[model samples]
Target: MIPSAMSATPQSRIEIDPAVVTAAGDFVVPEPLGFGRCLAPVVFLADYQDGQWGRGRLLPYGPLGLDPAAKVLHYAQVVFEGLKAYHVGGSRPMLFRPEMNWRRMNRSAARMMMPALPRDLFMDGLLAVTACSEPYIPRASGRSLYLRPALFATQPTLDPAPSTTFTFMVVASPSEALASGPLRVVVERTGARAVAGGTGDVKVSGNYGAALHATAVAAQSGFDQPLWLDAISHRYIEELSVMNFFAVVDGALHTPELNGTILPGVTRDSILALARLEGLRVHERLMDVDELLQMIRSGRCTEAFACGTAIIVGSIGLIGEHDGRLCPLPEPEGPHAGRLRERLLGIQEGREPDPFAWTHTVAPLDTSAPDRNG
Candidate 1:
């Protein structure tokens, strides 16, 4: 069951466009909702200026009037987060651990030298957009309402310092889990995703751009994603292009520790907590790519997979080096990975008990009147 929202004063001003509501009412999710390919018809928006944030609103989904000289355009002052809302079998629509994303977003904002959003404002914006978009949330297992909250520098200036103004928006998409089955991964020996003491732990805009080339190159070679190595010593495995790396070695789960370079993913943390509750031994350590490959060859490492908000849990079928050499995992179906994914899906879709209290229920919105504001 979905948990109730916290008793915070709603600061979001709602203004639903008739067209947006009609569009959502008339919309039917395509058979294949691939990742973020389908966007909801409405969005949540707010602004920060004069050293404070303004009131938030639920408005029609559309393009923004970003100036050509906007600070985000030139200086790349941006941070964002990805979370999901689930509504399956006509059950209560709910969000999964959104507070984590809120906390993580503020952490990124702090590192980017941006102002923090008030808790009420964040909650209001998230709930308002999600409530309005509830009609579009997919009701199938592995499908959800993917929510994206982003902050961008809006002030136009040539100064190198942080901008005085910023824009915060929450957009949603009705979609299925990104990627499917096992993934073919390519090891990236060159270039680093993040340095030792950089903005690697946060979901800033620049981090994805830095790893695009590697991912693009990997795709050309028939790989789903790139396996990023550590910045200083390229031997240790850090993470994937979008997800955290995990390997099942000797009946235990081994993942790279959060060493200030890997994004602290909500999905990754959930897996760690759930795995421990199941009495499974989980090790968070620096995994050497070379040693892991040898373990795979020796049959010690039976399975490996990647986990994130979008991908959830994707098994790694094969891992290859830059020289085009590929090594296949014996059990790509991932006996442990499959079990963990089931446990996760159960909790997410309301089929299993949620002991950790991660799911948050969203109240159904009354969109009967287009002019109604809340």
Candidate 2:
């Protein structure tokens, strides 16, 4: 049986606008698309006030009205989630590990003192939006409908307390694969994305915003991404700006363990599971930057990659100083990274049997029909 959260209810309601179908038909994707290049014209929205969730409504995508003193605008009390809907080899659109994203969003909200979204409401919002936007989902291998669900405090106050009102929205973009080739990462020795005993493990907006400067500096210096170290010592490797990092050293896959300072990524967990099942040794421990550099210098660390719901598995070709002092990997496209990427994408796209039961299929919405009144 489908979980109750995914089941339709008489009391639950969603309003679909008539413009969605025409927008989907008119949406034009380029011949060779890249990630996050285009957005769908429809969005799903719902409001929470007085401790009750309002009926969700599907409408044409547009800007939102916000008070100048909104808590989210001033205090940065916002959280979000990222997952993908796959259309390859599937009769309907399927989500890859959506429950994990939902759970993570709640974790982030709780950390920020925001109200957690009920499981049913969370699932309903994603399903309703993806169903309405199904026709616009890109139909290509390594491409998908990127789902972004965000929650923000809307109370017009400057108080540090949690807001009495909140807005939850789910928007989508038809995107191609994020990383075209191997990445070149620069070790971030100075800045820290998250602090200890802070919102490091959560998917809050501030976390990404804090990492922007370092990322920008890395980009200007010609590195593809910044590999952040820990906050205190800046010695222990934590993660990338938006993804988790991993390295294959001495035939073993080594990734930074989930310390209080690291985000527990769904793709990172999935990769660990698939690696172990495929008989590759996997280790989750404190990977020190100095130690990794030594390994790279000694030629023990052959390849590295970054994993996330968006990037999937992006191979790391080199790591080092910004002045082109590159620590080149023995194999940029290592066998393990390639094999694992294929296996994970296969499960997500329904090209292979879902042994882990991770994918969830959502039915398409009929835009021509009237709203089902609650």
Candidate 3:
């Protein structure tokens, strides 16, 4: 049974969908699943209007109706978060550093002029849906129930004003580790993901959409991902399209400093913490592309990688352009990256101790009802 405490409190005025419980038992799990290959059967939803939030509900996954002129459609006022639930060491599903996502989501919402989902509601929405979908949580290490919580404008207007109404929803997917091998990244010089004093620091929808073109171009050119440079001068290395970039130089871990143009990824933060705990020298500072390329050429840069919720820790094998000018890291599978990935994944998968108290475990759903035939 879903835990009663997982439900929203009366003060929050949240409601539960009667159909969600029925749908949970009837939902089917597929075989041979991969990362984000399939979505869970249920979703948690809430709405905001007139300066107040309405009751929330857990509903079966489906499309949402929206006006074509909605601010989110017209002005691109939307933000989202990505986290995961682990089903390791036990049947229960556990979230890793979910509050960080909650806090980051609110920051994005604020940047987009959208009202932030209250912390209680945010946690409740996530826990409620995870509880409902507990049976579907993947049970293997390096596999998880990927949680995505997003908020968007709903008002139908073109006046460039903040939407009077907004919708927030949390959805889940059974996923495996995102990347399989060392990645090849191209140094992007033609496009920029975010500009200074812009929404680059936020997890807004526009940021990802803007990167798709460059990412597509890079992918077609035989590169796994694009290493974006600063939008102002295109000199300093910013990040990968979806993940933060890091390089191991002279045995020291160096990543781009948060310059208000990089998404402060949860996994990125966790890796930094774990690295420090493991006694590695970690530095966050401006990294110039030319200097890094030179270091790689001189064998001074031993390794490079990208980190995010999706691609936990992916080492970079090669870095350069499509014109045959490339520099490869001395050690594609560097000792530091391997150690960090193993340690972090170990904590996430329950194979090691979670000294940071990052995981929140949810009880399994009751399976007493007869399985429904679809």
Q: TM-score winner among the candidates?
A: 1
Winner on lDDT between 2 and 3 is 2
lDDT for model 1: 0.86
List, residue by residue over 234-349, the lDDT tens digit for candidate 1. Answer: 99999997899999999999999999999999999999999999999999999999999999999999999999989889899999987989999988988888899989978887
TM-score of 2: 0.94
Ranking by lDDT: 1, 2, 3
Expressed as tens digits, the lDDT of each residue in 75-102 for candidate 2 is 9999999999998877888888888998
Q: Which consecutive 10 residues in model 3 have the weakest lDDT in total?
A: 1-10
Evaluate residue 156 in candidate 1 and report its C-alpha lDDT on the 0 to 100 scale: 85
Query: Cα RMSDs of all predictions?
Result: 2.0, 2.4, 4.3
Clashes of each: 1, 0, 1
Residue pairs in collision within model 3: 1-366
Please list the residue runs of candidate 1 whose C-alpha ends up more than 4 Å from where it truly belongs after superposition.
Answer: 1-19, 368-374
Worst 10-residue lDDT window for candidate 2 reads: 1-10
Q: How far out, in Å, is residue 26 in model 1?
A: 3.7
